[model samples]
Target: MDLTPRTAPEAAAPSTRRRWVPLLVLGLVVAAGGVLVARFLTSAVDYYCNVDEIGERAGCEKGRSLRVQGTVEDGTIERTDGTTSFVISFN
Candidate 1:
């Protein structure tokens, strides 16, 4: 007679992925949030410049954000397509 204890086959245990899924999702969210905040801060930093000076400066090329201060010429304001267009005079 066999004296060894007998055991039946058991179902496979759950995977480790179930435990790590929440942590993985949280990490991704934090990383994405950090990227958004960094972009907002960098893009928000702007320099002041006049329209006349922008043409002469090489660093004032396209894709650069600047605050252009000038006086709009009188009688040059026009409204079209829900947009206001005007000529600014920089002296």
Candidate 2:
């Protein structure tokens, strides 16, 4: 008489992670594209200055592009040689 045990071969489990890697990579690519577009759009906007901020003269200089906001005084408009100039008060 003999005492012995028999064993059967088992197959490996299938992997489900392969499907998620491509999706994750696609999401990352879309997010990076959005950030780059936003940065470029913001850079195109021009800078502006207030009436009281003219004396600072840090970023303000001649021939530089900028916007200024002020209220024109009554009857201060002058037109000469197809040009116009006006005086503004901060009051």
Each model's RMSD to truth, in Å?
7.7, 7.7
Number of the predicted model whose lDDT against the real structure is largest? 1
Report the C-alpha displacement of residue 85, candidate 2, in angstroms.
0.4
> lDDT tens digits, residues 1-91, model 1?
9999989899888789987999999999999999999999988888677888786776565678877889999999999999999998787
Model 1 residue 35 CA deviation (Å) reads 4.3
Candidate 2 Cα misplacement greater than 4 A, ranges: 1-45
lDDT of all predictions, in order shown?
0.86, 0.77
Task: Give residue 70's lDDT in candidate 2 (0 to 100).
Answer: 77
| Model 1 TM-score on a 0 to 1 scale | 0.50
* Tens-digit lDDT string for candidate 2 (2-89): 6787676787665678778898999999999999999988877665766666757665555656777778888999999999999877
- Error of model 2, residue 11, in angstroms: 34
Q: lDDT for model 1, please.
A: 0.86
Q: Highest TM-score: which candidate?
A: 1
